[model samples]
Target: MQFIINQISSFLKPDLTILALGADTRQRVSWTQSQKIYSLSPKKDLSDIRGFYFQAARFLKRAFRLSPDTITFDPHPNFVCKKEVDSIRGSYFPKASLAPIFHHIAHAANFGIE
Candidate 1:
């Protein structure tokens, strides 16, 4: 139950709604168009991935109101979340496009230099 949820909102017009999922370490859930989420991560250790999953799932169902047209997730083969992509997608965005993104690139795109 120890985690952090930070939502930063802004503006950026986009054709399709996009959801960006972070790697296991930061374990964030974010989106584009800037109005929904800035970044959502439960402040916790990587070793406790089980708890992370539960919290993530709960947060996903609770906070999200719209389904993204595309879903992007970290593709680390070893991470539990990577393997659980189906459940991660779950009733949340069954029709969304799911794609794999490199950890560094994904982070840079969102948290990188301007």
Candidate 2:
């Protein structure tokens, strides 16, 4: 939880936050949002904390400047990530836009790879 607190301390008022939810072997919650240039993939399988993560994500959206229409997710239909993302989106940001992007693409984009 200390890490979360530290993260809060950092001045990251993101305009968008992408939830990297896929690649079954390692179900993580990552983000490569705009307007605050940073990426975060907590060192744990966040799929287990689906509820908590969304709650916090909602908070991030409300508390910080995170955009309301850019809650993204993976496009892989079979991954549990999609289901949870649907649930989170429905329960939290129902009107948010879908910005589907692959996990590999996000990672590769980090290093300027196309």
Candidate 3:
């Protein structure tokens, strides 16, 4: 998975550092720096709401330290990961844009789909 992210990062050439919040199931936090991607392991499921927010807070702090230029979350509207990103956007990352990437599209990209 890490290798795949690395390859995508190289190909995309995102101009700004990015933070990606994974889906509700195996919640993950990934960030990029100089085309190198780093990701936190899958944590608790975000469907639990409270627990998901707590863990998300921690990961957000870690991601913030990297001063991400953009923040991405799963497109699932009900996903707690999306809520978490929205909450932080108001306070921690007011200038950063919130990008909601569709879940399946992300999966396909990771698998090397065009």
Number of the top TM-score candidate: 1
Residues 1-114, model 2: lDDT tens digits: 211322222233555454444344543344445433433334444545555456556655565545455565667776555667777767666777667777677666545411
**lDDT of every model, 2 decimals:** 0.65, 0.52, 0.62
TM-score of 3: 0.67
18-61 per-residue lDDT for model 1 (tens digits): 77666666666666543545566666566766457656656655
**lDDT: which candidate is best?**
1
Q: Return the number of clashes found in candidate 3.
A: 0
How well does model 2 score by local distance difference test? Answer: 0.52
The Cα RMSD of model 1 versus the native structure comes to: 3.1
Candidate 3's C-alpha runs over 4 A off are 1-9, 12-15, 42-64, 112-114
- How far is 87's C-alpha from truth in model 3 (Å)? 0.5
TM-score against truth, every candidate: 0.70, 0.55, 0.67
* Each model's backbone clash number: 1, 0, 0
Q: Rank the candidates by TM-score, best first.
A: 1, 3, 2
